[model samples]
Target: MTESLRWIKSSYSDNGGQCIEWAPEHANTHGAVPVRDSKNPQGPALLFPAPQWSHFVEYARKQSV
Candidate 1:
């Protein structure tokens, strides 16, 4: 399922070790967001429901990191 996904990292990222990649295209069509650590492309990905992903993003955006 993940093999065909076109993963994309956040524009806000600095291309550092602490970065994640998500396939927005897939999420838009499937209603689930696929996310994985950028440093580990071959690793397992976590699939979150669209609403949950939105919440997670909102929370992360408000963090100090």
Candidate 2:
């Protein structure tokens, strides 16, 4: 975790507040995506394998639509 992460908020997030953020640049180079709640920037982030995280996100997108 020595790398500087540029966390991007989820596109689906709105002002309603509950949201998540992910480090895409880290995922692209490291094959693991770090995700955290936007409300707690200092809290621990969960790491998910890039492929698995992609699949989960795709599934979630489909389910919501």
Candidate 3:
């Protein structure tokens, strides 16, 4: 795991500390979205393929931020 990956926040994350983080750069290179908790950098991460990640983002964007 490297900080070189640019982690982006979920749109659903607004004022609260609760958030989901993903590495867009990693996706560009690996074709997989590496997701983790913003509050816990060293925590476990979940990896989703591009299509699945797109669907997840679509669903997240539809929710209230």
Candidate 4:
């Protein structure tokens, strides 16, 4: 089920190994965001509500500054 979802890494993620991927399409279609470690595609995914996910991303962006 997870394999069918398209995952995208953060643009800020380089080849440095630490990376996470999220399925935005899944969020749009299902109203929940699926996030997982990019290095572990076969691993478990953490689902978050769209609004919570948006807030998380926003907070992350602010913290990066």
Measured against the true structure, the TM-scores of the candidates, in listed sequence, are: 0.90, 0.90, 0.77, 0.94
In terms of TM-score, the best-performing candidate is 4
Among all windows of 10 consecutive residues in model 2, the one with the lowest summed lDDT is: 1-10
Cα distance off (Å), candidate 3, residue 17: 1.1
Off by over 4 Å in 3: 63-65
Candidate 4 clash pair list: none
> Which of candidates 1 and 2 is the stronger one according to lDDT?
1
TM-score of 2: 0.90
Q: Could you give me the TM-score of model 4 versus the true structure? A: 0.94
- Per-residue lDDT for 1-65 in model 2, tens only? 62479988877778477888899989999999999888888888999999999999999999997
The stretch of ten residues in a row with the least summed lDDT in candidate 3 is: 6-15
Clashes within 3 Å, all models in order: 0, 0, 0, 0
Candidate lDDT (C-alpha), each? 0.93, 0.87, 0.83, 0.93
Model 3 Cα lDDT, one tens digit per residue, 1-65: 74667788866468487888999888888999899988898788888998899997689678946
Which digits, one per residue and each the tens of the lDDT, describe model 4 over residues 4-63? Answer: 998999888886889999998999999999999888899999999999999999999999
For candidate 4, what is the lDDT?
0.93
lDDT of 1 at 46: 96
